[model samples]
Structure formats: C-alpha cells, structure tokens
Target: MDRSPPVIVFPPESGGGRRVTIRGEAVGTAHGLFDVLELLHSAGLPAVDTAVDDPELIEWRGGGPYDWNDGEADER
Candidate 1:
C-alpha cells in the first residue's frame, strides 16, 4: 500500500508557487525550498530542514524540492 505522507507539495502553478498541504489541509504556497521549510516548520513539524527531503515526510507531486516552475508535468 502506498500511503501518502502528512505533508504534500503540489505542483508549481503559473505564478511559480507550489501549494502545500498538511494532513489534507491547505497550508500555504511556497516558491522555494526555504518557503516550503518555513511552512512545514510553522505547521509544527520538527527537523523540517531534513524532513523536506524525506519521502516519508513530504510528497513532492509535480517535481522535486528544487522545482519551483510550472514546466514540470503533474506527477500525482
């Protein structure tokens, strides 16, 4: 069974921002890794800097952490 993580990073929109959700609740939009980490930290996730890269912690839908553009196709 492929269960999704608590945090999900949606694909980047035309504005170059990716939507972030925690436990299915929309949190905010992030334009970069720092923004993502900030959101996660604000959401009360510990070790966010390292957690951002953990597949078990976050699900990067469209692209990896570095992708902040709309060029990538949706990977959901």
Candidate 2:
C-alpha cells in the first residue's frame, strides 16, 4: 500500500481538532500540533520527522506492539 505522503487520522466521535496520527502513530492532538502543522501546510510539505528515528516509520506486519516478537518478523 502507498504509505507515503503520510496520513492524519482523527479520533473517533471527535471533530477535526483532536488527536492526530500519522501512519497509525500518534503525533499529537490537533490542539497540540496546530502551529507545526500550519507551518508545514504553508510550506506545502506533508509531515515532520516526528522523532530522530521514528518508531512508527519502521515497518511492522506482526501481531501487536511487540517489536521483538520473533526473529522472522518483517521490518523495514
């Protein structure tokens, strides 16, 4: 699937101004990252690095949040 360009998902039963997620990972609530998002939006960019080696960006097709589930897990 095309995971690029990032996807921002809002919380359930909430309005646009709520918890946000990028690729299934929580970045911040809408009220939290408002300024950062605005800057990126104005620049025509899609996302921020979020962290120095984003854990969410690491591909995982496993069962749950456990990263070291097994040695055969597929990770990018």
Candidate 3:
C-alpha cells in the first residue's frame, strides 16, 4: 500500500492576520512554528508585528525546510 501525507498548500493570509493552513492524512491538528509576520507579508497583509517560530521549517526544494531567509537558519 502507498501511504503518504497530503500536500498542504498554505494560502496567503488576508486582512493582515495570522492564518494557519494544514493538509494531510488522518493526523491531529496542531499549530506548528510559523511566523505570523511572514504570513502577513506573504498574504500582502499589513506588517505590524515581527512573528517568529522556534526552529521553523524551511521551504526548500526537494521537500523539507532547507531555504533560509533574512536571519532564519536552515535545520536540515
């Protein structure tokens, strides 16, 4: 059997608020470490606060957190 996780497409936030999107199999819903500020920026929302996560996942090519921006560092 092929058991794989769903690809969650995080849509850009709207209204300059923190929005979290999740997509996957039968898994528990838990909030991961995400930057509300970045989410707002990506969603073209107003940049007011500087949100950050402890050891965030980098969205690099080939899956997993590999890309680093600004002062964010890569875990893998």
Best by lDDT: 1
In angstroms, give how far residue 22 of model 2 lies from its true place.
Answer: 0.8
Error of 2 at 41 (Å): 8.3
lDDT of each: 0.82, 0.37, 0.30
| Candidates 1 and 2 compared by TM-score, better number | 1
The pairs that clash in candidate 2 are none
For candidate 1, write residues 24-73 as lDDT tens digits.
Answer: 99999987888878888888886456887899889998788877778554
Model 1 has how many clashing residue pairs?
A: 0
Clashing pairs for model 3 are 58-65
* Backbone Cα, N, C clashes tallied per candidate: 0, 0, 1
- Rank by TM-score, highest first: 1, 2, 3
- Provide the lDDT at 35 for model 3: 50
Off by over 4 Å in 3: 1-34, 50-76
Candidate 1 scores a C-alpha RMSD against the true structure in Å of 4.6
Error of 2 at 58 (Å): 19
How accurate locally is residue 69 in candidate 2, as Cα lDDT from 0 to 100? Answer: 23
Clashing pairs in model 1? none
TM-score for each of the candidates = 0.82, 0.30, 0.23
